[model samples]
Target: MNTSASDPVTDAPTKAAPIIEAQGIDKLYESFQALYDIDLQVMDGEFVALVGPSGCGKTSLLKILAGFEQPSRGSLEIQGKSVVGLPPSQRPTRMVFQKLALFPHKTVRDNIAFPLKLAQVSRAEQDARVAEMMDLMHLPSAYATRYPAQLSGGEQQRVALARSMVSRPSVLLLDEPLSALDVKLKKVLQTEIKHLHRTIGTSFVHVTHDLEEAMMLADRICVMRHGRILQNGSPTDIYYRPADAFIAGFIGETNLIPVQMDGAAFDNPALRCADPTLDEAQFSPGHAGTSGLLMIRPELIVMRTEAPDAAEVDCVMEGSVEEFFIKGSSIQYRIAVEGLREPMIVDVQGTATPPATVAQKVWLSFQRRDLYLLGEG
Candidate 1:
């Protein structure tokens, strides 16, 4: 478990001092509880995305981190200093909101300089810092005189980010800053934000409901539910080894077929789980009868007109292509395999030749090693 920047893979935490730490954090609004006992640690220069359904406490946590709202209980620290009672202005953090919140009347330079001014930095220093931040955002120097109303959405977004970065805060908090943009623009900024994070190397705690956005930007992901932290780990861990069926369904597209113990091995009537990778070690007594899901990613299944020998493939099932739609570079298939109530999705490259058409028989073969057994669906 490497916890330092020198490690090639940071699937585990880094050894650096946490840039932000929360212990036993809770939030309550009179009789209503907005957060449960939450403990989190964000390492210096790491990008952590807080994601969940609406009203799931992601935003509440971010607000607490920025000092806009105090936690109902527990302690928080930034740079190892307790900030339980600190005001937003006094904290070593900055928040960029979905609305961008650039001053309508202020020019780009002034908007970016406002935070430095509040800190009472010298005018010369403020100008130098703003110029440096603008360069980091790749905003042209010529745009300094333009107001928010004159710049495009991407430009305004960069300006808002510039303002946040100019302060050189220990951590940056984002509240769905790109949620309002069109899909194309949102994707473009997602890449830019991730790139900027690497260039600036600041701890970013982004709050969003968009799973793709979280996957695109974060070094680590914290999944929340009902005001509680449900899971936290690397993207691969979260996707390939989800803690539960709900997490699997929410994180990406997949076919979660019900499975049960058929004698010593797990079995799904609709699909087969005969891969050698699975055995007694993978099952528990409680899951003997029927309480698991055979998680198969669409991309993991190979579509074939002729079935492979059972001994050669992990799991094999016959199905007919009931429907399909072009999805960018891949074709998404809705296959009605034997015994499954709902159709399963099989994703294949768009260039697949002699493609399977509606009502066409096809074989869905997936490696047993690729099958993930999820507990009690």
Candidate 2:
């Protein structure tokens, strides 16, 4: 719950020791390259998430860091020590895979105690640690005797987390750990994972395709694409100021309109704004004829009836409501503007009052600052 905006570890002048570091990491599978010079760093006790599509090499990079596979080029260091040749067990890292990997016959207590037994901890010590881990994971003491088959999917995941943490490794790598659980169970486990990180104070490198999960739990998110890091920042940063079109569209719902920057305004007679100087930052002096993308979030745009006689600062665009969908807490509208090729999506909270029907004439408007500029298609 230490939610200060400024970083607490590094006082000022000096940089803090990174819990995990990977530089110029490369992985190749004969002809195709799975990873290419991927560089990343995780601070002590930070929860960092790696997110991307299926073939984005997220798993390969994580495996490389875990010592499951050595990188073809580059280096990896954990807790300031080079672990290139070290075995997974020797490195101060524990990985919890998608499959909880719990032994079906073993009881919860026995499962959590497995790591301790492998390390040759005394019987009494192992029992004590197992009890502590179960308590930390909020599992009932009576459930310790029950087998994995008797536990729910979430319970199994908790057991996996407990097992991984039993050794008190400096870093924990979670690879899509909640993908198998149902929606409700996934949401619950997400919170549990966040809480677990707070209590344990271990650096967590979580890999997932779920953007919302990454946004909610991660202190920083590293967005990957085609085996490379595209953008790395906090959730707010990624959502508000996406570094590229790929990230802007991937992290959340966005309408990337193809437009040209003419002077300070986005040109398209149909989508012209009140203030022509609105999107001036999108264009450079020498880049006049270049095409650019206007990144607009659905939530930032509002639907208004009749023209307002207010200041000449607001940007307005005319579009006809093509269709609408009722989400739990909001309504989504798909509107087709006059000149735009694709329909613009607008999201409004609490079921847009007197919602528009199909082919209804409507005006979509948004502020200047809300628009983000990105490279053209």
Candidate 3:
């Protein structure tokens, strides 16, 4: 089908020097390979996220970069210097963990100043840096003497961030720092982290299993699968133009309908109700095949009681609304078809004119570009 990935932000196509670069990276545990030929680059001042399910090697890759673990084979460089064998403290990077790892007995000022102490900075410098970090994190200086246990979760997070940044590392490593918080707190921290990244002007390598968090925090995302990078791109690229079937399913709720491909054109009895205005012959013969999925996002599906204006839309399909759900700002309709085992989910604005009701016939319309052709796995 016609390629239709939304370009949310057009960043530089290349950089003079990457902040961190890993080449032919591999990690093995006893004979089990955890990562294979992992090559990636983090540009200066960019936020890159490593995302995948459990045991997907995202954590391993992060550890390798942070010097907590060494790659079995590869070259790693930070700020144009090779850091393959350097310790975490020696490398130009810092890590923030999920548990915060803040000393419960230590006050906020002491916690943030811990890094300065390790570097043997003068006490005057330490106090000055600590105050600056607290100010940057928006933590009141009055709370400087309070212990981490006395602060709220968000406050404690700010302290953890302050500790990590006080060292002035060029690269900051975050291992699911926000995953432990509740949804609301997580969202607040997400914005705070992004703002902090911008203000600090440092490259950030964040690791998380939460896809939405990565989408919110990362300028670029590396999707891993079974110890391999599956796709790497902007959020728009990953969501709208997924590289393959697995990414399409993993990134969001999608409806995969089986369709028959006739040469470069899609042909199936199910497509008969589609509007003629759609660019039907969008696919090429080289990638033509019957064992493929017509991938459509639920939000893109428009349900109506009457046929949509053919000229104003693309394709339209006939189905019956079998189930209905009221989301906060959107309504979900489960439309049933003759051959499909499960219903197709169609999402529409909650305030749409004459919404669909359960057990009612409805039409689903969407653009031709919205029709993503993915090979069935």
TM values, all candidates: 0.91, 0.92, 0.90
Task: Provide the lDDT at 213 for model 3.
Answer: 85
Residue-level lDDT of model 1, residues 1-377, one tens digit each, is 64446545755644677888899999998998999999999998999999888999999999999999999999999999999989999898999999887999999999999999988999999989999989988899999999999999999999999999998888999999999888988888888899889988999999988998888899999999999998999987777777777788889898887777555456666676465346553442324354577778899989988878877787788889999998779999999977888899998998755488899999899877676666774
Worst 10 residues of 2 by lDDT: 279-288
**Cα lDDT of model 2 by residue, 51-75, tens digit:** 9998999999999888998899998
Encode model 3's per-residue lDDT on 158-217: one tens digit a residue.
999999999899999999898778989888888889999989899999999888888888
Scored by lDDT, model 1 comes in at 0.86
| C-alpha lDDT of residue 128 in model 2 | 88
Clashing pairs in 2: none
Q: How high is the lDDT of residue 296 in model 3?
A: 82
Candidate 3 or 2, higher TM-score: 2
